[model samples]
Target: MRRNWTDTVVAMLVATALGGCATSKDKVLPHGDHTMLDVWNQETGGSAGGGQPARQLLDARQGLRRPLIEADVQAAPANNAAYTRTAANEIYRQFHRLPNPDLVMYVLPHLAGTDPVPVPGYTTVFPLYQRVQYAMPGERLEDY
Candidate 1:
C-alpha cells in the first residue's frame, strides 16, 4: 500500500513537471504574416536582401572603381621590388623538364588460353622511371 502511494506521488510529480514544459504555440514560434525576407533580415541583422538595392549599390561602387590605363600597366613591373626584368620572368625563361628514358618492350605473339588462340605480337613503350623527375634551379643536365 505504501509503495503504491509513493509511486503515485512520483508519477504525479513527473506529470506536473512535464506539463509545465508544454509552452503555448504562440510563445514557442513566431506568430505573424511575415515574409521570408523579413525573417532573414531579422535573424541575420544585415541590410535587407533584394534586387531593388542592387542598382544603387552598384552605382555607389562605381564611384570608387576606375579603369586601368597604359600607365598603370607599365608601372606594375617597375614597382615590384623582389624581382626585376629577367629572362626567367619573360619568354626567355624555359621549363626544361628532366628527361625520362623510354623502355621499349616487344610482346612476342604466342598461343594463349585453353582454346589456343594466336595472340598477335605488339610493341609497347614505357618510361624507365616511375615518375618524371624535375631539374633543380641551375642543376646541370647532361645531353644523351
Candidate 2:
C-alpha cells in the first residue's frame, strides 16, 4: 500500500492544534455525554463489608482539610478576640442588610437511635457553610 504523506501531515497538524487548545491550568475537564447518576455511580466509594476503608476515608478528610488549613494560615487572626470581632461585625452587617447574610448559622443535633447522642463516637458536631453564600431570595446562587 502507498503511504499518504499529505494525509499524515494534515493529521499531525490537527493533533498539534488540539494539543495547543488544552491549557496547563485545566484542573478538571468535562466528562462528555455522561449523566449525573452515571458519574455518581462510577465515583461511589466501594463498600468494604462493615464500613468504608479507613485509609480512603482518612485521605479524603486530609485532602479536604489541606485547602482549609492553607486558608486559615493565610487569614491568620491576631487573636481569638480579633477573629470573633471580625466574624461578629460581618454577621451584624449582614443582619442590617436583611436577606443577604455573611453567614448561615445552623445548629443540628447529633442523634443515635432517636436520642441526642454524646460526642465520644456516638455523634459529633459537623459545622456546615463557614463560607456563606450571600444572595437575595429567588436569586440564583451563581449570580453572586
Candidate 3:
C-alpha cells in the first residue's frame, strides 16, 4: 500500500509524542548525594576533599619539567638533526620554488576616447610563467 508521506510523518509524530508521554520515571543510575565538584575535589585533592593537595601536585609536575638550556639543546644533535635546521634551510630543502623571472613591459603613450588627451607611457612587470613552479625535493634546480 502506498502511504502518503504526510500521513507517515503524522503517524511518526504521534508515536514520538506518545513515547514522550509514558509514565516511566524510573532512575537509571544509582542515587548519589554528591555534586560533580565534590567528586572533582576528592580526586584532585582540593581543600574540600581528601587527596594530594593541588599545590604539591603542581610542584611535583613542575619539578619533572626541567628547563632546556644551550648545553641541553646541543646534546641532542643526532636525534634532532632534522628538526634543528633554521626555517630558511627547511623550506628550501625539497620543494624550492623555481625562479619566476619578471617580464618587464613598457606601454606606449596613447590617446584617450572622445577627448584626445595623451596618456603617459608606463612600465609594468609580470611573472614570466602563468603560475609559480616548484622543483622536486632533492632535484638539481640550478641553472643548467
Candidate 4:
C-alpha cells in the first residue's frame, strides 16, 4: 500500500508538469474568409456600412484634376539670350575633374642611422595625364 501511494503521487506530479507545457488553442484560431484587404477597407471607412463611396475613400484626389490656363503660365524674360547661350555651353561642360593641377615632388637624399650611409635623391611627377578628365557618355554628373 505504501508503494502504491508513492507511485500514484509520482504519476500525478508527472501529469501536472506535462499539462503545464501544453499550449492553449483558443487564441490560435485559423483565419477564415476575411483577408488583409477586407480589414483595410473596414479600417479606412470604405465599407458599405460607412455610407461613403468606396472610390472616393480609396483616392482622396478623385475630383482635383483641372486644366491649366494662361494665368497659370509664368512669362519668360525678354533677355533670355545669355541664359540660352550659357545653357547651350553647359550641355557640353565636364564638371567632374579635380580642381587643382597635379603636383611635382622632389625628394632630397641624406645620411642616417648610427653608422652614416648616403641615400640617392629622386624626383617624381603626379597626374599621369596631360588634360583633366571629362564626363563619360551616359555618366551621372550629379554624382560628381
Candidate 5:
C-alpha cells in the first residue's frame, strides 16, 4: 500500500510540473485579445495562415523628388558670399607677401678654404623684403 501511494504522488507531481511548463495565451496577450504569435506575425509581416501580401519597408529617399530651381541657385551664392571680396583680398595679400623677412647678419673673421688665409669680417643682408611675399591671384612673376 505504501509503495503504491508513493508512486501515485510522484506521478501527480510530474504531471503538475509538465502542466506548469505549458504556456497560456493570457500570459502572452496580457491585456489584449491577441496572442504572442499574432503580435509576432504582425510585426514580422508573416502571413497569419492566410493569403495576404507581406508588408514592405519604405526607402529613405522616396519623398524627395522635387527638382532644384533658379531661385535655389541664386540663394546659394548669397549664403556663402558674405566676405567674398574681403576674403579674396586677404588671400591675395597673403599670397603676394614675402615668405621670410630680410635679415642683416655680420660674420666674424674666419680662416679661408684650403690655403687657410685669414678672411676679414663682413656684413651681408638676406631676403631683401621685410616678409616673404607671395604672388597675388593671377599675378605674373614679372610683376614683382
Candidate 6:
C-alpha cells in the first residue's frame, strides 16, 4: 500500500509539472493601438502576453511600412509623416496579434484615413493592422 501511494504521488507531481508546460499557442492575444513603426520599439524583449517573442512585431512593422506610409492620410507634413509612419507601423505590427476584436477595431480608424486614395495604390485608403503569433522555446523568426 505504501509503495502504491508513493507511485501515485510521483505520478501526480510529474503531471503537475507537465501541466505547467502546456501553454495555449492558439489563444488570440490582445491587439494594442500601435502602428508598424511603434512595433519596432514595442518589441524590446518579449510580447505583452509573455508567451511570444518580440521579433514578430519588428518584422510585421518592416513588412507593412511601404503600404501604410504611402497611403495619403492628408495630415500636415509633420503630423502626417510622424503619425503615418508610427500609426502604420504600430497598427500593422500589432493588429492581428491580439485576440480581442475590440482592441483591433479600436486601432483601425487611427491607422486608416477618411478619404479615398488620390493616387490609387500610392495612397492608403484603408487602415491595415497585422496579427502576431507566439514562438516556441528556442524558436527564431525563421522557424515561424
Inter-residue clash pairs, candidate 4: none
Candidate 4, 38-126: lDDT as tens digits: 77766666553344555566466656667767655544443454456666667865455544356788889978788998878888788
> Can you write out model 1's per-residue Cα lDDT over 44-131, one digit (the tens) per residue?
5436654545566667789999999999998887788336666656764234568888999999999999999999999999999998
Scored by lDDT, model 1 comes in at 0.76
lDDT of 4 at 63: 68
* True lDDT of residue 106, candidate 2: 49
Write one digit per residue (lDDT tens) for candidate 6, span 25-80: 55545566887756754455344433245566567778887744543554447675
Q: Comparing candidate 2 with candidate 3, which one achieves the higher lDDT?
A: 3
Full-model lDDT for every candidate:
0.76, 0.54, 0.80, 0.67, 0.69, 0.53
Cα deviation of 40 in candidate 2 (Å)?
A: 23
Compute the lDDT for candidate 6. 0.53
Model 5 misplacement above 4 A: 1-94, 128-144
Candidate 2 lDDT by residue in tens digits, 14-52: 999998777564445645687776555445543323234
Per-prediction TM-score, please?
0.32, 0.19, 0.36, 0.36, 0.26, 0.20
Question: Which is the leading candidate under lDDT?
Answer: 3
Pairwise lDDT winner, candidates 5 and 6: 5
**Clashes in predicted model 2:** 0
lDDT (tens digit, per residue) of candidate 3 on 84-126: 6678766655676888899999999999889899999999999
TM-score of the candidate numbered 2? Answer: 0.19
Q: Model 5 over residues 14-119: C-alpha lDDT tens digits?
A: 9999987797978965697888898777765566832232423222244555688999888987877754767566665434443565688999999989999999
Where's the lowest-lDDT run of ten residues in candidate 6?
100-109
* Candidate 1, residue 107: lDDT: 97
Task: Please give the lDDT score at residue 88 for candidate 4.
Answer: 66
Clashes of each: 0, 0, 0, 0, 11, 19
